[model samples]
Target: MSGHSWLLKLPLGKCKSTFNLEKAVCNHGFFMMAPNRWIPSSKILQRPLRLADNTTSVTVLISHPPDSSFLCVQVYHSQTPSPADQRAILKQVTRMLRLTMRDETIVTKFQSICPEAKDINFGRIFVRPLSLKMLSSASSFAIAGKRKRAKSEKLTTHEANNAAPMGNFPNFEELVNIDESCFLEKFKPILGYRAEYILELVEAVKTGRVSFQDLENSTEEQLCYEQVYQNLAKIKGFGHFTCANVLMCMGHYEIVPADTETLRHIRQVHGMKNCNKKTMEEEVRKLYDKYAPFQCLAYWMELLDRYEYKVGKLSELSSSRYHLISSVLFQEDTSNK
Candidate 1:
């Protein structure tokens, strides 16, 4: 665990006034998932980042010193990371924090449209996709395959006896080059039919059946969101919810990834009593149409507020309490009865 430590500074640019590290990192549930840890005491976000070598993972601590204008990324490693490795680490951190000018503009515009979100600075947080391959697999697993206790128990067992810790979840290159048997064996705990979907996505990428170049470059002119959505729909196990979630990660926010929870939110918050599975999409579209391109952000802002109302401030939530999040939500639902 011994390693050299050094800091790399990234300027906040126009985002300095709007950015709050705690608010940005804790704004999303993915922060509670594997590999990402937000230390409340130190006000540092720590995670193990895979270097360019792909084999070497260095622990990185990201913090913004009080009254500082730049983010400090402290790399803990056996040696200073090469320039490429440093770039890789910074890229991941930037993606995780949505530190781009475009992202800041999105938040600014979103808040103007939805005054309720003006104070909270919603839509500024995002989870790292790592790569399209990982996004496909992880988003599928999260939205479709992950059940509360059942999946958690299975993943715990897998982590204990079979696969690497969740922190080292396979990267895009690893997934592409991984032996099919090894991939199946490593992910069997949560794979189920998701294995087929993940592999199908990998093969699609391998064969150039689907292009992620535009997404990687963040080039909206070259990206057709609907085409991507249609292509993803062709993959087994990718329904509307999963595809919308993937598109949202890729920066298309016109659609909300509605689920049972969304239905509840609409019924209770929006006063839409007849909103069920069949009408969920239409109802949500009508309700959040005012937000237009940032519909998902507005919807998510309300949802996150609801979660905080039930549990507590997400920024102050302890890592140890992450597991109880689902139960707490369930309890809120039942208690209303």
Candidate 2:
């Protein structure tokens, strides 16, 4: 685990195909999860991994065999990573590969609920509803002048409840991603109005109107997926497509966060020979209606099948595939859903 990066064998207990590995590290396709710098391709995923302390950066190559039981991760650098760094790498790997691990009982329960999804490589695409943790972190809130407190000094339940101002608990960056200058500069064409909406989202987070954790636990709190969807829809810049994908990321699979790519895939794979935006959406909802509450996951699985068959992997395809995911205009009155 040290001295000029080497290879390590880690078990992939629940992942059935190496294609899941591609999806795990490749969040947006053709583009990395912003600020993480995860480079992905058909055969390998490369990333500059920071140790848990953030003082060091190490590059690693990740891959696995299709349908194999274990993943092969290679850490390559001039210096060896520490044990903590190795653990960080593993933890991040597990996060991106959510449903592919042995110990994630939440994923298992979700699979039990959606047995139809047993064949789908669920991955981070789904999460345990109430217990799901948003990917927001202290660094995300640092721009607002809130720094994390000492980790060794744990807060009690009561202090934690009253500790909103104690540290950088508000994560404005996750939505706007101000940390990545490159994304803000060059990708303005991609995120245009959504970028403005992120500022509103940060305000919502800061004002305690909509906590990220609230969205995470919405399902358990008697908020039906649609109610939560409406709640999120109330936010500025959130339309059918943005709200849907946001909820999907928060573990709601009832909707597919549909876009033109969805339209294209439905046209190409579902045998819908001709389709405008309305027809494409109707076809998708019809195709996955039987799998309601699991439609997003189901749709993603189908799309992934076609995607892997086409390129054998996923890059930051989210932005590149749907070049106009948010900003593109569709047929009149068709809406963004």
Candidate 3:
């Protein structure tokens, strides 16, 4: 594990014209979550990816040159990965960056209708969560770890233990095989109830009650949005907001997750004083209806614009500063409006 790293270059193919690694990785908050690190100085994203064997996870440094046709993935490991491992690494990177032909088409179509989105390459963004299981685990991590902090707060010993340079999540199958206590012990400092829901979802997937193939469109025939929505809704703890967010990650963008952030965007950007929780979804739908199938992307671009405006470039925002990225930090002044 101490030898020189091996580099693998993946051609961008149809996505070459629009793929910008910085925009792709930096546009989403998920990139700031555990295990993913973006270095601003070098414009490289580093993350530990679990190989197909489910036993070995390798740290990979990913970057794309300004006009190059290939995306460079540098695997930091003692041995060169086998062909299977290389495919696994590339697959994970592709999923994380949304670099498929379908994604390129979505970006092209989205920009054609919303010209303002072209500059930021909104379609190239939307990095998928490492896995659905990781989302729940990460959420539990965030919730149970919340506390008041000063601007210069140092990492506590507990936090330091949890914040391994190479993150601590096991592969999906590996996670499914673990007993409840083992799972909890591994994901220490997590909300107990949140951890329960994560286990439940994992069990459901393992038992064929819900299929990731259907959710992620790995099947030969694609399931309609309604079908996928209903499937995800059956999972405990997956409300409208969670389902929609998950759906967006799965490449369905017609539905936007209308949380408090959406309400804030509606109020500040659209001047909707009365857009409360009840009317938030309706208001957001109306705002981005023109974007149609790409409604989430459109809404996300607006939010990203406001975020970067307030916090400066996300690429430059250190991973250590991720804890400071709360809604209050990006809240805009709207009293005069």
Candidate 4:
């Protein structure tokens, strides 16, 4: 599509809208979803967005608000997304908008102060992988013997392509190795006492005690963070942490996945003391203020660490080590799949 500069809307008060399609294809190039900010890349133009769960996915249609309106678009990025990335994308968009408009206002945090400025320039953006390597790398402590380099070393885009293999991402189940008991064990301590309970529940479905197709068909029966949270809450073993971890492991069956280090970063940077849904949502908005578009994964990781650190679990582990472990593990598992 040709640039529709005049079609772009100007900033108004607290107005944000999300389109189902990828924002890069939208006229503005900068996806304008209120309260969330995602700057689109020129290299890639469009992507699909799934809405109403997996029942429907569409190429998003973003329009200039009928009246005087401010717009922002949030897009879901995944190896393969099934609508669970909303919170992460929201956070990223918020951060990107904040960074792009940072100089514009002191009072208006996320809302743009410059409503009249026709063209705003926000830089290149991409999502950070939540699999083990980046997190483990961020948490690693083996730097004692190595000399410090003046510049940071990043994975070459080519290496990243080999490791991550962009485009459609793998679903959660496909990404994890079920045969590795040790893998389960690494996540077990973090799973808390409710581990056995969740495992039984998953086994029931996997073993056909509960029909998989039936459960996936039934909105209420399908296992995921929200459903599992409600189901496991009825039992005694599943506390908040346990339930959250189990939800993370369920893969495509359910997703409430966020890790410990990311959560810690959110708490430290955003000053959130509790992990209540509202507070978490607010933090998501704040993250959108900094890291638009790719902020979803960034938000998830930061919040994961925040939750873990607040509960004193993630702090003990070397941040980069965990990131490296997760990175290598995620890569190994995903690549083979």
Pairs that clash in candidate 2? 28-316, 28-317, 28-318, 29-315, 29-316, 29-317, 30-315, 30-316, 30-317, 31-316
**Local error of candidate 2 at residue 217 (angstroms):** 3.7
Per-residue C-alpha lDDT of model 1 across residues 120-197, encoded as one tens digit per residue: 667675677366532433311222223223222122332233222234455455567567886677676777878877
TM-score of each: 0.82, 0.58, 0.82, 0.26
lDDT of 2 by residue, 1-337 (tens): 4434467666876454323654454534423333333333445655444446542334456677776777777765444656876776676666555643332553455566667455554534522111234344323234434333432223345433322122222334444544545535654577786655666666677677767676656755757788889877777778899888877765566888788678767766775767777677778778887766667766776766665555444554433544443232233114423
List ranges where model 1 is wrong by over 4 Å. Answer: 1-3, 53-55, 129-166, 176-191, 214-224, 335-337
Q: Go through the candidates in order and give each one's C-alpha lDDT.
A: 0.71, 0.55, 0.71, 0.33
Candidate 1 colliding pairs: none
Summed backbone clashes in each candidate are 0, 10, 0, 67
In Å, residue 240's CA in model 1 sits off its true spot by 1.2
lDDT tens per residue, model 3, 54-95: 445666788887789999887765466899978878987888
Clashing pairs in 3: none
Regions of candidate 2 where Cα sits further than 4 Å from its true position: 2-10, 14-42, 49-58, 65-88, 100-135, 138-190, 219-224, 227-231, 271-275, 278-281, 305-337
Tens-place lDDT per residue, model 4, 130-214, is: 2221121221111122222221122335433422211222222322223335535754686764455545644554454544344
